[model samples]
Target: MFSYCADPSVLDGWWWFSCFLTSATHLDFYRAFGAVIALLLVTAPAALAMGMAGAMMLRSQIRPLSMLGRFYVNIVRGVPDIVFFLFVPIALGQGIEYLLHLVNCPDWDQPVRQGNDFLVCRDAKMPPVDAPAWVRNLYAFAMAILAFALVFGAFVANTLHGAMQAVPHAQIETAESYGMTRKQAFRRIVLPQMWLVALPGLSNIWQILIKATPLLFLLGIQDVVYWARELGAQKTSLYSYPHPDWRMWYFSILLVFYLLLTWASERGFSWLTRRLSHGQATAEGERLRRATA
Candidate 1:
């Protein structure tokens, strides 16, 4: 920005616009996009790991594990995603702080749950009572990631469990005839095929996750959507750089952002499907084999 930007009142046209857009708040708006990216990068793998665990439990020979898996996958999938979004972070946060209170304040003579309040020692607050802004934001971001993982992992587990069951009985029997145990057969054969079979469903979930990133605003994160709405609202004559409502423009930019994300995800999934389809017996793989011959 030019030194002329120091007197924004006198400036107009390009000079005024330059300083306005590059303001501290606008810079935060720019950084909020990274917050969304960070959420996705961290959450996808976490959700997948949870899903894999649930799916393995679902397919476990032990009756208790299988029943527990069924209960988890079915119950979570049945619940509204908004309920978990609203509930999980607060519940986990309180639960964690309660444990910390028990360990740190054992000599204290106060009830943790008097009336409706969930009280804990000052030391029990997440990120600590005196922690800085970034630390608090990071703590909230981690909670959001956990909630997303819990909600989405159920769908992923169902997808993977179905895919695992879809693996042919004949292949399992063949592996058994070759003196391989069920675990060995599953690890060597079923697991790889499950990924291929589950790819489409997983891709769908990926796209849904991309769209759902906007919901970060609901969880109190200053995500792109939050920034867009904030910075795009009307700035009146009282403000240094007054403007009419620009929310339509801001949201239009978000529209393009989401569309591009969906496009890239589709291309990536298509490539992955092709890569995993090679030399396999699935329809896509068989088609590839025929094409090469």
Candidate 2:
């Protein structure tokens, strides 16, 4: 970006470094870091909401709801995460298109599955063939968000389910003794208490979710990992900013990025844990009480 960067061939020392760092490719790499953070910010809460729903279903009195919850938790937890990462987006996309096709092209008699190809009418094509690049990117991102939420949601459900159970039966009973319904008892007592129990597991899940953001590259999102490899690859004299193999350096940067992310996450969760522990009967709460006194 500097005026001196106009001719990279004549640049040396810090000037060379500055130009290299500010190159178009390297700038794209920096933006990819934002992509990683965006995925985490969007996916974490969505996955938590999905998990909360699944956990509620797991605890439901209705047989079918309970069974469905069990199925979701069991199947998702049992399957390899990479398998779902690969399969769910394609399946969900096709499913959306198929539903749209039924509505938009009702009279078209051609089957959707014709041997090897899954075809949909032009009207039912997602984002449409003529859609802008941003539209396609948005669609892909939405799919990635769903995939992350679904996979992580299952793990969250399992964690929350156990946390829900860990709440003392007496606490619910006490709420009932105060003329509260099962729902009120759960909302007022069980749910709040469950967080204290669930925090550690959820914290771990958050770490895993951070680590998993790199998989966005596999799903065709040009995430930080993709940019790292692209920008760090060896370049020849033909290129304006030539460099030797720098994959290790690029990945080292990624490693530091992840380490910082994890470290910050841990500190945040620790603060959250302390906040949640306040006025509770847990050891953390007691320690806080002692410290404050």
Number of clashing pairs per prediction, in order = 0, 0
Q: Give the alpha carbon lDDT tens digit for every residue of 1-293 in model 1.
A: 45666767887787778989887788888888777778889989999999999999999989999999999998988888889888999999999999999888888789989899888988787779899999999898899999999989998999999999999989999999999998999998799888899999999999989888898889888889888988898988644477889999999999998899899989999999999999988799999999999
Query: Where does candidate 1 stray beyond 4 Å?
Result: 1-4, 237-240
Top model by TM-score, which number?
A: 2
TM-score of each: 0.94, 0.97
- What is the TM-score (0 to 1) of candidate 1? 0.94
lDDT of 2 by residue, 1-293 (tens): 77888878888898899988998878889999998999999999999999999999999999999999999999998989999998999999999999999999999998999999999999999978899999999999999999999999999999999999999998888889999999899999998789989999999999999999999999998889898888888888744588889999999999999999999999999999999999999888999999999
RMSD of 1: 1.7
Q: Which candidate has the highest lDDT of all?
A: 2
Q: What's the residue-level lDDT of 192 in candidate 2?
A: 76
